[model samples]
Target: MEPVLLAAVVLFAGAYAFINGFHDVSNSVATSVRTRALTPTVAVVLASVFNLTGALLSTALALVLADRFIQLPAGTPGLGILIAGLLAACGWGLWTWWRRMPSSSTHALVGGIVGSGAASTLVGGPNIAESYQVLLQQIVLPLLLSPVIAFVLAYLLVFPTTWLMRYSSPRRGDAGNRIAQSVFTSAFSLGHGMQDGQRTMAVIVLALVAAGFSGTTGIPLWVQIFSGVALAAGSLFGGWRISRTLGSRLVRIDPLRGMSATAVSSSMLFLGAVWLQIPLSSTQTMTSAIVGAGANQRFSTVRFIPLREILVTWLVTAPVTALLGGILFLAISPLL
Candidate 1:
């Protein structure tokens, strides 16, 4: 790749990292804000700070997984593919924003890369089956499972705790629940750093590798630091629109329920970060945990209406972005 073009690709990837941070900010703070445990500004600031810390401290598991999924063949025309992928992701993001639907930027990026890979195959580029399998196992399976797991777990955990606390004074119960919420919220922030922040780090590493600037052995410290800063800055800005939907629209969350949900979600995210090294969607995991906690109280606690919209976005994200990526790649290839 030409030096100038590679620089442009790296810059574009950084922009994507920032957008990913902004797009997913709600995942980290929505429950805390909605429950009034933390103000929106305070919640975001804390989450942002923790996000940067997590990125800096955690291992680069997601980066390796992503590289496996989207590695272009040696001598593959990378500039066109990179540009198309970024453009396609941006297009999907804009569409989601316009519709006021919260979608996964990670999914959008995957879609773009897959689309470009398919386009490359049409012109006799390297096979990408390994990448596809990684996507299926890591991304798709987790998306399907996280919410169901969260809903079940939350439902089971919340009701029992509620029942146990029923005889207590409301004031006493609130105080205890608030304390628990604080702990769970902190844990969730750490997990958010481990899981969500790592996704951007992975992308940055991928861009560097593509540009012949890094390797699979490990990510450079500067890359880790820069990616962390970008993501944190984006989180600090926050996304109020999606936060409302997640924090309030999903269900009425008291401190106890909030703690239960956050704890379960954080557990899942941390496991993914530490063990699987797969890039699971924090939004999906947390939402599922929230649903599970709500379901523990009653099936009615799980709001099906907003969930229906989210499901639609989830289903459409991969295919639509993939198609867009393919189109963009084809259009830009000749110019390159």
Candidate 2:
């Protein structure tokens, strides 16, 4: 039973990574695609490559997730919760993607785990207080503040970036901004991979520990490769509908603004993943950055309705997914 449950957990984790890839790829490439900095194919390829590279480079955030956020009991019960949580996260991801909403996959996963963890506590799992403290300090705070910071910084960044190109003609400015946007797109893709890939890695590690495959909650190379490859494949597939939401519908973004948004987002990603060792929603940060850059140009240029809708989605994602995950755990645990 443990072996079978472990296999299922690993498989579901990979699938979740794949869903996350296409689901969140828009964050890295949307602005560049919108501004014509890169063709869709080129942008996707760039994202895939860098995302894979980023996934390979970091385990710090993964460690934090596996060790700090929530601990699962060994054997069947733990594996069952993880499987249900992944399913709930995946379901929300697919729904949001279908609706072309730029929601936070990070929040969804966290919510799922939280719900599952809470459920587990009802059945003799570890105390939820410590995990909740970690969640608030590490996950919730960073996820919430990063977007607001991204918005403000991107808004301010437009001043410098815009000034630098003020002397250039439209054609020349677009060309320069395209080149810069591509550079930042690569950086953002790398950071996105590192941050999001770690989420998958942490899940796989938890599964491994619960299965007794490993006594420790460390991310192994095979786990990294597995998570990275699945995520990269998803990125290669791309999410055209959500891409359109972030790239075009959110704002009529110019190349310069696109570059600024990506820059701001990538910086925040690095800060969260590398320095803070926290999980952030690249979706929120990038989307907020895009809005900030757009908002700086003219209030009317930034569409409020979609922004409002996206915000509502963000606000509700955790709690809704938590409910879904908890319900899923209850429904599926018996069968397992």
For this target, which candidate reaches the highest TM-score against the unseen true structure? 2
- Candidate 1 — which residues are off by over 4 angstroms? none
For each candidate, what is the lDDT? 0.73, 0.88
Worst 10 residues of 2 by lDDT: 121-130
Q: TM per model?
A: 0.91, 0.96
Error at 329, model 2, angstroms: 0.7
Taking the candidates one at a time, how many backbone clashes does each contain?
10, 0
For residues 266-320, what per-residue lDDT tens digits would candidate 1 score against the true structure? 8887878888776667777777777667656544666789978988998899899
What tens-digit string does per-residue lDDT give for candidate 2 at 1-336?
A: 888888888998999999999898888888888888999899999999999999999889999888887767777888988997898899999999999998998899889878877876666655355678878988899899988899999999999988888889999999998998999999999999999999999988988888888844467889999999999999999778898889878788998899899999998899989997888899999999999998888554988888899999999999999998888887876765
lDDT (0-100) at residue 219 of candidate 2? 77
**Residue 130, model 2, lDDT:** 66
